[model samples]
Target: MSTAIDIAALDPASRDAGAVAHYGDPVREQRLLEEGVGLVDRSHRTVIAVPGDDRLSWLHSLTTQHLEKLRPGQGTELLVLSPHGHVEHHAMVTDDGTTTWLDTEPGNGDLLVYLERMRFMMRVEPVDVTADWAVLSLVGPGTDDALKSLGVDEELDEPDTLDVPGAKFAQGTQPPRPSTIYRVASLGDKSATVAKFGAGWVRRVGNGADLLVPRAEKDRIDIPRAGLWAYEAVRVAARRPRYGFETDHRTLPAEAGFTAPAVHLEKGCYRGQETVARVHHLGRPPRKLVLLHLDGIATDELPAPGTPITLNERAVGFVGTAVRHHELGQVALALVKNNVKDDAQLRIGESTAQIDS
Candidate 1:
């Protein structure tokens, strides 16, 4: 059978955070994701496993989420904050009965070092499993069927799947429920894994699953996959913010819509809790996350990141990400001043934009 998207000339150089830019027509691949299903290779993303007894409570004391109560087979995301409450790292976590699995973005060496340094006396041991594991993404409507075809079943224990809680897998805005993420076998024979595409950890995103496998085996896993460019378009369209783009060293958890998924409002005493509470009750973040609909009247392309958003030719904010939506022609996400009126019409270059409800 033919692969869904052919990427014979896929430039190994044009990568975003080390993942391919596109297989072929990013537009068609994106359309396939929304209407049916598509695959994405996420091996560039990293995975770390924390083992031992003190793992839960120790990690809970450091990050922005309440992970002390994270049960086996359940998954959630958290952010590590600097002492000043800036978001330093983002981790998607899942706990098996024995170990806590953490999934993070590419170029996470600093995150790993920080995590290891914080482990002075705790029984928890942070292991960088990136060398031994790889991650793949099964995106869109038919992900479950694709997994089944590749031997992912409840009865099998080799490949584990963690459907991210609150990730919208179906075509609606309804809240998502946690599902059993199968834990498959370890990485060994490269040829065998490439042929089967099994034996890895899977995490659900807004519309699909992110599969993790061994890094060395990545080249052998010849599968049709979408790239970060396509994924970012849909993600921005969904009003979801990413780590490197929407957040940074100066970002407070609340500033990037991290309040729900990455922060617990009532959770006690993590590194950034005081700032989070202070902002939640007394002050507003200097800026707020907003989705902007770029005007198609004069231009077909969306403005690039860092493009100034202006009102009456006065700068109000800068664009974070912009993409051509499958339905909504041109869209972008911006962190505008909180005082910017909700109905304000802003301009990006010569094109106008609006903050939508």
Candidate 2:
């Protein structure tokens, strides 16, 4: 909804080593991925407090992850999809019945509202803990060292998910007792490290590692920080689909390639249960998401988002994203019709790409 973004609004006092640059400026996003090992003032993350006994049941019914399997000091990634199975909000949930923190995009306020409207008889209470806290995320090579630098380190072989008043870590190796969440996934060379917490403590906690925040407020100053480009680069390589871009109001979980984690096929029923079950078990989905490699350069430029991709001049699908690669050439993610052969020749804008089998 925000058409124009003031880049510096992300992290004004940004200090990152080996940061990426675009248009002569440091791509502040490095704080989360490339340099996930550095300090960040993630003061904008939204935190929701769900307290009460039935909290687990209340959330299990709404999210995609299996809550019964999760223990305290642990967190899991989830997607709260619409009844029709379109992604409403991609979320990460952490709780063991006492309290749960929901971290999601700022645009998805409806999630909080929806939970409130439905909390009539449930003993659980959903409260917005945002004003009370701020969070920072780091996702790269030196995360462990950074945490150790902060004196938040533990020697557990299995990265431990810690419980902070407003924080959680989701993935890493042998972290500490203070680490709220931990996860293991395929990043570029090493997996990513995503940490979440309150906005107010950005400086107070990071200072343990001798890291300091030069900014006083999250909304008052503009930080030329990270955005979707850098975020998606690591996301795509991890085969993760972002909400609005890869999954949205019109797209379903299966087609977005998140069925395994987003849907419990054997579970009794859900919003779009019938349709999802039908396509999943009996019928073939109309379209399939596939990666593409444009065969040659375009005369002018590659097609923009939603431009029809053609093979033999017949419409097959559309381009979702195009990333120019130094090693692999121009690669893209596309939602091509199921009929398109794996070896089908493709036309994107004025160039040709292949459907690598």
Candidate 3:
């Protein structure tokens, strides 16, 4: 298979090692990502294909989402938890009738291995397809227009299957959900295979869409590209908790804001259902994910991820992703003790961080 586009080769001067950090102006790129359309190279993430007729049922029995009735082209998030209910894996999942596609953060090979091991007598086969496919995200309010520019639009043939009913477990706050896959006709003869198989388009936050493009056809599509910095700034502003950053070995799904979209409280037994039920009914998660506004801090002065958060000189939690948002200024997502007041003043280094209202 052809290798994915060398993102650094697109603009070496703006590259940050393997991934592009920005073109020449990240703030401008961030603005474009918010107000206009910004293309993001997400090829660094991993993709796994679980094929076989038993794929959906097997996955539904194992994970934390209701996937047995996941219609083709529809997308959702799911979690794999430890027996004790700590988060072990998280992925953005979509199906294409024959196969279930899971896209997750880099270095999550464990998710693949775990799935493979759990197959048992099931007919499911998990295969890594990252090398054969690439992920490009179109972020901003003009995302639909940008897809139209690429000759891709809504898949009208597929049923509108966005609503998957379940208990509202995250304090009644609805999380951002993935949209149905769209067919891309711009890739010529390869478009049909892309649509029916692995690669296609799925919607994301900021009215954006994630294009799962074949590695061979990556260069065929053209748009103004933004870097990881621009993409992350928007994500941080959205209060979306990522796997490795906001989560650790002991991170529970409820603690990091994954409970609503990724968990089905009424679903049958899965790996960690017991703990999730216990926490929801009898108690609360020890930590909660919160957005912090780093008041008066410059872009260069932002603290790194995993920086300890202190409240009243006591260690409360740790910062996750921090970025200089276009309108929100310096902001971050932090996992703080659940007892920390929403209006509490926290400290990260010498900078003062307050939970955004």
Segments in model 1 whose C-alpha atoms lie over 4 Å from true places:
1-17, 155-198, 216-224, 296-302
TM-score of each: 0.79, 0.65, 0.83
Lowest lDDT sum, 10 consecutive residues, model 3, at 179-188
Q: Compare the candidates by TM-score and give the number of the best one.
A: 3
Q: What value does the lDDT take at residue 109 in candidate 1?
A: 78
| Residue 239 in model 1: lDDT | 85
User: Who is ahead in TM-score, 1 or 2?
Assistant: 1
lDDT of each: 0.68, 0.52, 0.75
lDDT assessment of candidate 1: 0.68
Estimate, for each residue in 1-357, the C-alpha lDDT of model 3 and write its tens digit: 113344367545321336667777788889989889978887878899899999999998999887777777567789999999999999988677787889998757888999988999999899999888777888888877776666555532322224333333454232223322233232232464454433455544335777777877765666788878888898888888999788878999889988766887667799999998777665578999999988845346567678899988999999888887878888899899999998887888777889976
Q: After superposition, how far is residue 168 of candidate 1 from its true place, in Å?
A: 28
> lDDT winner among the candidates?
3
lDDT of 2 by residue, 53-132 (tens): 87766776666555544555455556676777666777655553356666665445678998898787889889877666
Better of 1 and 3 by TM-score: 3
Give the clashing pairs for model 3.
none
